[model samples]
Target: MQVLRWDGGGPMLATRDSSTLTVLIGTFAVLWLLWAIKKQRKAAVHPLPPGPRGLPIVGYLPFVGTELHTKFHQLCGIYGPIYKVWLGNKLSIVISSPSLVKEVVRDQDAIFSNRDTNIVGRTITYGGADIALSLNCPNWKMLRKIFVREMLSPTNLDITLALRREEVRKTIRNVYDKKGTHIDLGDLAFITVMNAIMNMLWGGTLRGEEGAKFGAEFKHIFAELVMILGKPNVSDLFPALARFDLQGIRRKAKRISETIDRVLDYAIDKQIKSLAKAKEEGTTKTEQKDFLQVLLELSEQDDGAPSMIMTQIKALVFLS
Candidate 1:
């Protein structure tokens, strides 16, 4: 008889639960409405540049194919001379016209002087310690001043004249020796320039038989580095997934950086030993100063100017 009688409180309990659920649903809707209203108000206050709406997460990244320049040109036609493109979470404004380019680079240079560095660029430049990829700041300004006023000054260039001439003569001789064989002018030119740069940097050169072997290795590594840098990296587009490095660009960059770092370290060690030997022999005054020497001296200085670190020196030397 007790089981046959239904519990009337069961219905009441069910009704109470339904009512609680209703209240929660209404609260959620109210909160969502408030958020949407706030977002709309903010957008109204400062509207962004007109651009195509993208997908939820990937944005326009997928649509931009290998021919980025062509795709950008097409987008320019559709969106006007200047428009925004959402590459994942990052927003980039494309200024296709020359006038705007000049305005951004020349007229408002300081305002837009800072560069947006990617993962590969940061790695290659040793966390933007080099001038080319560094942010526009006091350290960058000091580095620029040193690079322009001291390192690449007419006096410094004149001092390195003999080094440059020696490399050029060696290159000419190498070309003459290889006249019978099929010549790659590009490789020759690259090696010549690299040798000249090394001479100016630390009074070294990648010439002769041993030097040719090293030069070839360097060329291959540099080409690989350049290819990786130019590739479309998912990590660059989606910063949240950067740690995952879906494309392995970061890993490649790190390996290349290590190889370059070793070469730089070897050169630096040799330079330091030479400098020390000169000082000990009382021939420091007679030793012709190279860019490395100048940078090393600057590193030792306690002048008001921002002091250069080993990383910066290496970055500058590598970049040069």
Candidate 2:
């Protein structure tokens, strides 16, 4: 623990030990006085929510446990729906009641629209430009519009309907052909779902044994990636030590990101070549192009706002 000293503006004591004790005592009293006055003034301005008292520096973390869900209910019963809890340097407010939740989410969405982005999230999202992690702004709105209006519009869905139908049909046929063979329904469903998302993201589809093999690889790799993302890293908690990457979380993240980039590069190259051929032939060859193509096209346009970059494109692709 780092010990911070304050030069208390109070009467000095005789001995060194006595002076130190006096300074500490004076500092605590002054801080407590200021906090009390501020809280009183704030209460006068607007009624504050109730919560348990916390110790200095550590906040409520030392008392929390793995069973946070249960603890949340107990705390709610005591402090009501809207209460605050400090986790390290962060202050978290929980809202359990539907009415208050609505006030925050629906009534005043703009005030609380953006979710907090952490250090690990920034690394995973390539500086946090991804649609999911980005702050609420025109850039985020643009990405959402491209995703919803361009990629998921009625025209685009109609074009890709056949591809989705094809994958589902294949899955059904495989199930029928296998009959009584021992199978993992969860994995089968996972692969089918992954294939559908992959198709939508990059206009690629893995099928039969190939689909199963790719899906298995992805399941293991992505599970590990997710675990690393969720793992507590000392580096993230202490930004001063962030460069060390002490837990190797950032290192693993870089490796995973490289793999994803390589895959996206290959897919992007194939799409470009196909698009070029179609342009030359003066015809359309396949269904609506994937989100990558849409993004690439948008990036080519030099608008007032900053053009989308490859990192952001990869972030979106990784999410899909």
Candidate 3:
């Protein structure tokens, strides 16, 4: 039968290829197992806090519920105040003890100053360009100095007090006019605080009418942004799959970021044009300079102080 058959060696080639592939796969799996064992041994040398074991690949992701705080509390009860949780491939350590928290926040603050910003957070914050999300470095220190020493100085806060008062009064009047109607106090408080912040940022340039219109639009955008930020993202849990963006969180964040950038650009352009016109007319400016103006002027300074770029300015404006 074998002598009678001549199939051009097709079966033989297929068998050889299959054998080769099997060998390669077997080799890879053995190597992986050895690597895992080595890692476990190394970890044993400096053992981590005890916690529940998880399944392969997915880890404990499947077991976690939507009410994460409650789950964390239960885990704390079982594993003491500090324990590690494997959320997908990421290792998150829970710190529930008050003394441990104080030690991290006060005694070891500098060691833990850098933050691990998620994918969506980084996209919206211009790749961690702002002080809030950026890595702790010289640039971060510089931004903090600008924010605390310059923008939030006692004198600057005093000057912006009128802006805050105006917003509070406006909120109170609005509430009075809508007396007995259903009103969400949370939303009301957020709007009041946001409006005050907006005024303090650019009230010197934007007229009252313009500010009112812009504030409404900005509030809606800001609410959407907060909602997006609060949602748990799969990409954040498994960073290797971030490029795929299975949940589309990154796309939504990018769209919101673009909208905010456009708004900031409009305001910046208007301010630049107004400043130019003032210079051309030789008019003495009498209005209090807003945070935007101060940041711009500082950017132009040739002094030894660490200054900001346009990208940094926009990033700070959005987060501020």
Candidate 4:
């Protein structure tokens, strides 16, 4: 018993161990306080939707299946027609049942008619100047009226139908010529539809290298836009994180916008020049009526003034 002497190193080692423990404890306390503060702030701003709790920061993003529509419908079955899910920090209200959809889309149309601004629509529609994607304000209403009255009216339907018939006939003729040869029906259909739309809008068909370039560009851009729109974005959920734009959505939108602007600018310039030439020669005729002529005439009138901007004209022309 007397041989059990005091070890001098014991106290020094104990002191070091205690110091490390203190540091770790302090760090943990600080982290916990910060987390509490964040939770308090979130709770103060917007009430969390009634739903299952999700993991920290990530929310229910990982639990969502590959097919969003299917997952949404499934969730609706469990949570009812109107259920909320978090992509990250943002909350998305899913409307699945037909009755709920009708109530929201039809009955409360005015309240819910505003367009959802996202990366893709902003890019593809020139910051949403196009009638289809633009905000549901007076400007949008004006454009919509113009589109309905001038471009897609019952009278104009005949123009579109005639062009469609001619295009289809030409496509059939081409297929007949290529009989027994391997051909893509989808591609032929796309070409026919695009040519018909273009002819109706501009009174001419896209052809040669320019046509090929425009077709490829439009298809590529449209595909990109569709893909983006079809997918729900994580950025939309977290407004604070939107500044980061983690998926490069904004960048892609800018690139698409620039490409579209270039093509549209050329088309507008050509149309303006044509209008000027026709005016100079007194050959501006309405017998060969088209969407452009109608829009120009409406632009000059103030009977139902809508403050139509040049950008609106460009957007309408591109869409037509």
Per-model RMSD to reference: 5.3, 9.0, 7.2, 9.3
Measured with C-alpha atoms, the lDDT of residue 313 in candidate 2 is 79
Clashing pairs in 1: none
Q: Residue by residue across 213-258, what tens digits does model 1's lDDT show?
A: 6555666788898899888888888889999998889999999999
Sort by lDDT, best first.
3, 1, 2, 4
Any runs in candidate 4 off by more than 4 Å, and if so which? 1-49, 160-162, 204-213, 287-289, 302-304
Best by TM-score: 3
Q: Which 10 consecutive positions of candidate 1 have the poorest summed lDDT? A: 1-10
Error of 3 at 210 (Å): 1.9
Assess the local accuracy of residue 275 in candidate 2 as a C-alpha lDDT between 0 and 100: 66
lDDT of 3 by residue, 64-99 (tens): 889999999999999999999898889888899999
Record all residue pairs in model 2 with backbone atoms less than 3 Å apart, i.e. clashing: none
If scored against the real structure, what TM-score would every candidate get? 0.82, 0.76, 0.82, 0.75
Clashes in model 3: which pairs? none
lDDT of 4 by residue, 85-147 (tens): 867876677777799899989999888888567766666666888898887788888898989
Give the C-alpha miss distance for residue 58 in model 1, angstroms: 1.6
Candidate 2 lDDT over residue span 1-320, tens digit each: 23345558755434567668999999999999999999999888865578777778657877777788888888999999989887666677888999998999899988898887666677777888788888889989988887788778897777777767777988999999999899899989987887776666654433356545644555566777889887767665556677888888888888876766666676666766876777799986555556677666667677776677788878887775
